[model samples]
Target: MTIQVFLPSQFTAPEIFPVIRDSFGTFSEIPTEVDFEFSNLRFVRPSGIVFLSNVARYLHRSGCRVTFSGMRRETNCIRFLDDSKFFEQHIGQAICEGSSPRSTTQPLREVRHEQSHNWLRSTLIPWLSISSQVPEHDLYNVQTCISEIFNNINDHSSQDVGSIFAQWYPNERRVIISVADFGQGIPNAVRTVEGELSDPLAITRAFDNEFSSKSTPRNRGVGLFDLKQNVVGRFGGRVTVHSLGGAVEFRNVDGSVNTSTYNVNGYCPGTLIDIELSTDRIEITNGERESFTWI
Candidate 1:
């Protein structure tokens, strides 16, 4: 039997999570075809685009014939998604004929653990440098902040790959970035370390500096805490995380870091870290590259 999945009006998180759970959660391997209908999709965010790409990548690979339906009705959304390389990377063809000139975003990409650093240095940073006018040297801290996410995914995830996308909103002086993996969600990973806990509490506590899942008591979850601290506490940005059934948001208001959590509609398979960073508030480095020591 083929599953009829309706892409929502707003292709963003929280809203999309429920659809994901209902549509694909029960399958050990997707046993039927999927029609990812985009008929009503209007506005799409960075994470939302990656979610679409992620679904296409995972479902197609599972031998589930996926069809990206109903595009002509929403020309603008389809064009923007096409410019972001969503169709190209997923369906292996461009849905829209031409790219948008106002498309100030990187194409959605799936990067494995091994190629992450190079993708950061070669593609992401350079894009940011040109768009934000922050010298590549000055953006090292930004690079470091995102690298921590990669480390966390690499350490915690069963899959070596993760989907990533970023956008620069010139008028708002904001940069939105998202990375996610379809491995075990954050709450599931945390449950392995700390006994049984509610999904909301699991995600909230996962930000603690001392909390870890490793036998050696090293920090992948805490590294995320540091990422939150650096992004919000230092750079005055915001982070929203959706792992399984919980949603946690870290926002910087008037130089203060505020955190809030909520229960999502349904299970969001893995961990998605979505960041809204401010280009105006970011601190630039001295153009000297700083090497990291994992040990």
Candidate 2:
């Protein structure tokens, strides 16, 4: 049987969860074909972009014949999708033709485990240089945090490729970066080592500085911990992780750590990390810096 899903006009985080739940339900029924309708989609945030791409990737991987239709031209929605290569990644290149001229206003790209280093050095750093006005020294911290996230996907997840979307809001002086992977999520990964654990507890433990699921001699579990410290503790931003059926959000506001976690209606099936950094708060003072090198 064929299932037709209509996307919302304004696709943003928290609000788009309903669509995601419904889509997952439809796909779980093992539909012969899935058609995504984008006729009314006028605006989409970075989170929505990642969510949509991840969903498409998931559906495609699940042996469903997926097709996209009803994408209206002469709209910011179509332009954003075109520039981000969303159609090419999710649907196909043929459908992307005459969609719209690629928008240069934001930097959004996909990252693969094999090319993580190159992506960091070439795409991410250069984009930060122009968009955030972040100094060279401070760039190391950003690189370290993001690199850890990528490494986690490589080391922990079953999937190798993931989507990354970033946008800088000049008026707000903040940059939002979103990364997503369609893989075995945090809860299942942690359960392998720590025995049975709830999704929320597993996500919380995954961020602990002493938690590592690897059996190697040097398996210091500081990736997520250090990411939280750099993005939230130091930069005074927000870091959110959505894995499986649970979601956790961390924010450092007024020098205080604020965190919240809740359960979603349906499982995410993978992981999604959303980070927001305040450009005005990031101090680029001259000081001793750690070697900004990575494999």
Candidate 3:
């Protein structure tokens, strides 16, 4: 069978999940030729980039012949996708002659699980240090957020690799990154402990400070509590976690940060985390930062 999936025009967390859940989520049942149409793509963020790329990968791995269509039609989004190296990373070669590692953007990248730490230490942090002028030591909170994410992928993703993309907005003094892994999912993992909660509830529970972690000794993670602290409390940015058929968004509204959850169009097969950090608010702490104590 042949399947044609129309990607959303506004490609963000809200827009992409339904397309993912309806088509990519059920690809294996038919597993024939699949074409992902990009003509309708109007706006895109880090979430769209990582999700589309990873979904293509998942399809390919499952023995389906996958093709991307509609690139010939030109739009600003087309230019952004090319410059971000999205097409190149997806197809294993440059789709357009490109200039990258720009002051405002870091092109799409794939990080395998075992090399997560080194990628952080050697590549990502250094580039972040240079681009944002935030210094390496001051980026530990950022590191903690991503490290905990990687540790989550290691323990729950059921896959050895994940993908990441980042964009910097100096005028806004913030950087946004999205990471994805094709594994079970936050809802699936948290359900093992919480037992049969809804996707949104399970995901919310995982981030709650009172929740207990079940990771192995080799992969210790305090779950999303610390991630929330680093991103919202420390860096003054928003963090959104999307998994299964639900998503939870945490951001500052007025002077207080609040949590909210809702369901999306379909289940996200793996976990995709969107992290926003305020570059102007980078802080270098003295001694050790306090860890959240489980209640």
Candidate 4:
């Protein structure tokens, strides 16, 4: 199981609270009241310690024992009266095993904008190179989806200084691409620009039609919205966003939306987007039966 902590980075607490809660429920199934232990810890900012400590207190009151395997250094622990877990022990295995050594590199600013583009180009070109063997329609759609996600990170997540560290597990046909920064998360950014948006699900709604952070000269009105439309509506895939104290799941089959809010242990920043593409779908692309790459 994974324990995620969300704190204000660029986004405010209220805005991201619902997002975090939704995510927490999505990842876990409510079990009977008992002591539960988890090995994974994900923290965004140091301020998240307050929220986590509060969670520990609440869990104790509920007669549920919650023990975190590790703490995230990025989180603020000073606010907490007691240290809960070792920050590195649990996550070290997941990070080491899932990550690709070559994938770790310089920050986004160090590389030219085109460098990012080229990174994607390299990942996509090989697939396109074997276009003759694959269905052109599927290739077009998959490329579009990947481009939408990559462009979103470059445009919004990168900001002035940031980096994209992603690890793609070709075996499982799963890609975990994380665009992190000391910048504001999506929820907080939206709240600042749009006067009090009471909808705690604003971040989830952003994936729906017409929801965007851009105010002026909103042209095309595509990208993320289109990505959702194609991925869920067309391809049978799932989209998840872990930010604040909530998690939002966009299920593709029936266009169903699931949301929940739960208390996380610490303040964490930025966003980590994980996409699960079917092996059956990936095989239909390019020449091989099972092959995938990330830019």
lDDT scores in order: 0.80, 0.76, 0.78, 0.41
Q: Give the TM-scores of the predictions, in the order they appear.
A: 0.92, 0.88, 0.90, 0.49
lDDT ranking of the models:
1, 3, 2, 4
Q: Which one wins on TM-score?
A: 1
Candidate 2 overall lDDT versus native: 0.76
lDDT of 1 by residue, 1-295 (tens): 6898898899896678788888878346584688888888888898888766776677777888888788873377888888887877876777666553344787788898788988999999999889998899878867877877787788787777899999999999899999888777788878898879888789887777656776775544446777788788888999898887888999998888999999988767778889888888866767676554443
RMSD of each: 2.2, 2.9, 2.8, 13.0
In terms of TM-score, how similar is model 3 to the real structure?
0.90
Q: Tell me which of candidates 2 and 3 scores higher on TM-score.
A: 3
Clashes of 2: 0
Put down candidate 2 lDDT per residue, 1-295, tens digits, no spaces.
Answer: 7888888888765556677677655344667788988898978888878877877776777788989888876677787777777776675562545654332234455678889877887777777767777775667778778887887888777778788888777789888888888778888888989999888789888888757777661336457888898889988999988888888989996897678888865557678899888877777778557653222
Query: Ten residues in a row with the worst lDDT in model 2?
Result: 99-108
By TM-score rank, best first, the candidates go 1, 3, 2, 4
Q: What TM value does model 4 have? A: 0.49
Give the clash count for each candidate.
0, 0, 3, 32
lDDT over C-alpha atoms for residue 144 of model 2: 73
10 residues in a row with least lDDT, candidate 4: 78-87
1-295 per-residue lDDT for model 4 (tens digits): 3334433333222333444455444223433232222223232322232223333333444445454433233333311112222122212222222222232111111122445556555644244324223454445555555555555555565343233333334455443333333335556656766665433365565566656676542424465666656555555666555454334556655554334433333333444344444434433544333232321
Per-residue lDDT for 1-295 in model 3, tens only? 7889888899775687777667656544856888988888889898888988888888888888888888743577877888888777767665545534456776788788789888888878888888888778778668867977887788787667898988888777778989999888888888887789998888888887645447443323355777886688766789998887888988877646689999867767788899997888776556455553333
